[model samples]
Target: MSYKDGYKWRQKSKQGFKTKREAKEYGHVIVKELDKTALLTKDTELKDLTFKEFADMFLEIKKGHVTHNTLTMYRHAVDAYSSINNIKLSNIKPLHIQNVVNKMVSSPTTINSYYKVVSRIFYIAINPYKIISDNPCTGVRLPRVERKNMIHTISDEDLNKFAKYMREKYPQAYYFLQIARYTGMRLSEVYGLTWNDIDLKNRKISVNKQLQYVKGVITFEKTKTANSVRILPIPPILEKILIEYQTHELEFEYDLVLNPYKKNGVKCQINTYLKQFGENLSAHNLRHTYATKLLANGLDVKTVSALLGDTPAMVMKTYLHYSDEMKAAASNAVANIFS
Candidate 1:
């Protein structure tokens, strides 16, 4: 370990750590010890801060800035590091963080969430807190995440069956499903819609906000991103259905198009129908079906992204394989045109 002693670089040597990671951690310890007095604040000691203590401070600072959902995630992250709660900030090593990561038996996606939270805490400890110089979470190995073959979508025959079932059995759910299918709106966004958002005369639908479950209550919240707030052109089929459904609209306190009380049940029933078709699909599958069809039918990524209220980069990434198939079709068409 090396440090500057009043302008001249000085070196301190140590030995006997089992592995290179352990040796690297020991080196950080040495540097902290050598400059302990300088690192300490007037009101706080550099070596006295525990992981739990720092995490508490981090959460307290985060509470006001982040959403309720994000704060909940941060809390889960703090709980995930309970094993190392008592360990001093300066004493935590890559091995300690790695052990905690390995102990988590959850899915890779969930584990990554916890890892990100722990990493942020260590990052804060290194910066403004100055309690530690190195972030131990950097070298921790997380479980590998397996990517899916493709995003799931409903086949045309299955889609026709689904539409027929919804229309016959649950007229309200049928209308909701049609809007989701045609516009590719999220479940929350579809639930958030009101008659005011729909312009049957103009054939337009404005997506302004979304409904979220906050503190056990369904409340209005901003869209997932700024770009998520957009306007979509309503197709003729959807417009025809909306016109008929409008005649049967009932009075509701929230002025929502779909019944909030029965929407959950409707979604559950839709999911049940999909499961019977031999796959676990949900309302979001309607969205996937829409995007995949549009891409297959020659819509550009940028235009589809704008319609879906997502970035073109995100659209391409999600459907790159499908896009390649579309490219092959286009190539065959171009060759046959001259032939």
Candidate 2:
């Protein structure tokens, strides 16, 4: 390994690492011998390659870290930020990326997605590639995204109306919506349900795995978060639905709640139903709806978070949008205390 001015350490001297710890140890030694001050900073090799070239290498390295869907999204960010495609990974500054982001008039959420992916690209360009010393993405800022948190959730009344409509209009896949509405499961998690995962005798549901469609094949992925793998009581409504649903013949995956439909197919059907009724809903909205209802009804953030497969902090940040009545109740509580 050699440490040049811009290229901090080039492990090209050694073909590859035999073990993770050994490689990391060798890297730590290089850091001490070279900069000896701060952690891995951007280095000069960045100037040598175009962003496209760097991306090819960066994405290859990324394959081991991210999921296929995540990698697909990274690819999309590359495509969306067309202006940065030809820039040199090293010469590219934060301002250049910030300018490109400024021009892409889109939702804050969309802008954030683009910004994060680009940031990772620059991060790759920095340490391992040693192409640039400073991560340009660090100095860059995307437009602020406003969370329409309260309006985003479907009210309990609306959920009931929609669930009833779905049950009558689309019987086979109806429970999927009900599960998402009541339990706050992701579309994939809803699809992942097998009869084996449910315990009607005990009125409990175990959410340990998620079913997703990756590359057109039905895949079983681990739940998004460790918090996501929870056991929740079967709500009275869900209990009634599941008991009826249990009678359906799910020959292949006998225990799955949604045996008849794939993930996308279920989504398409739900969206179609929503369109028919002029309802604007998403799969995540159902989860959010469930979470919001729980929080709005005085359930603690921690409990709601577990049910929704998210952190309590995350639940408070994203789910708790109190209604006018709830806000008034808060005011009344303070007034009563003061009086």
Candidate 3:
């Protein structure tokens, strides 16, 4: 045995530690000395934890604060990491995160969400658990997301044709599509609607809850924020449709106007029905069409924003694609002033 720098070391014979027990003892002593040195160097911090283990601990701590939807997204990100199969926690670098993000470029929103989850996990591991001295994701770069145009406008002629097609093919879903195109409500918001949420006397509907399908479970959750809880006035034509739909519901013994058969059915079923109508439009596209129509009709950005339950900046940034006639009308209005 020999001693150097407060650490004890031993030299074995030509066989180099004859028994497995001797090698195990040597390893234990070396680990103990390293722990002592680490303590003396700084605070006593936990060491040698794998990334997967630390991520689990971080998510456990985060579970109570976030919504179920958010937790599911985080779990998906962790699951994706596990599927990579070749990642080593100790050797993980920023490049690994970038590589994963690059592979998910087709889904920009999902990729960004995963990056946020990874960032949060590393943050908790570094500050709370002291699992690693530094976060490997610190300098990682996220993919650039190009925001797509959300405004989808149908001409009056096209809309009339669509309405006619709906009446012929999908009589049940026709009023639902009309309501969405007029009200600008999200698919979840529409699915969560009940008789109590509507005020026929005032020609308005109140947004209180949102329906979400997480892992195939249809759950009704609160709106994202108090600001998201809004009351939108129904158009006169839409009010008439609502009255008709209510009458139809009573006649058919259905609860919901759109889906009279099921109390709380999934909104994706509506999308399926729309496809059958030859419309090929999602519920969200109805909302987009609503906003575009409002913009084309000379409504100010703020009013359209409030009606769509979005900020003015979001409305202008996302849904300001105007038609040629609308653009020409604006030009003519200015030209008339000069004339």
- Measured by TM-score, the strongest candidate is 1
Q: Rank the candidates by lDDT, best first.
A: 1, 2, 3
Model 2: per-residue Cα lDDT over 150-194, one tens digit each? 546665676677778777877655778888777778777777888
Question: Which digits, one per residue and each the tens of the lDDT, describe model 1 over residues 148-248?
Answer: 66888888788778889889998778878889989999988998898999999999999998876544577777777778999999999999988888888
For candidate 1, what's the RMSD? 5.4
Stronger candidate by lDDT (1 vs 2): 1
Error of 1 at 91 (Å): 3.3
User: Which stretches of candidate 3 lie above 4 Å from their native place?
Assistant: 1-50, 57-70, 83-93, 102-109, 123-138, 213-218, 249-257, 260-281, 320-339
Q: What digit string (tens of lDDT, one per residue) describes model 3 on residues 1-339?
A: 233333546443223898999888887776665554342222322345566776677679767665577778899888666634344444577777777776763477777778788877776656655445456778777777777544445556656666776777666556666777779887667766777888989998988877665555666677755557899998899889888777664532213344533322434545664464346565567787788888777888888888877888877778656544567898999999999
- Model 2 lDDT on a 0 to 1 scale: 0.72
Clashing residue pairs, backbone N/CA/C < 3 A, model 2: 42-132, 42-133, 43-132, 43-133, 45-131, 46-131, 194-255, 194-256, 195-255, 195-256
True-vs-predicted CA distance for residue 101, candidate 3, Å: 3.0
Clash pairs detected, candidate 1: none
Candidate 1 displacement at residue 124 in angstroms:
4.2
* Candidate achieving the largest lDDT: 1
Q: Give the TM-score of candidate 2.
A: 0.75
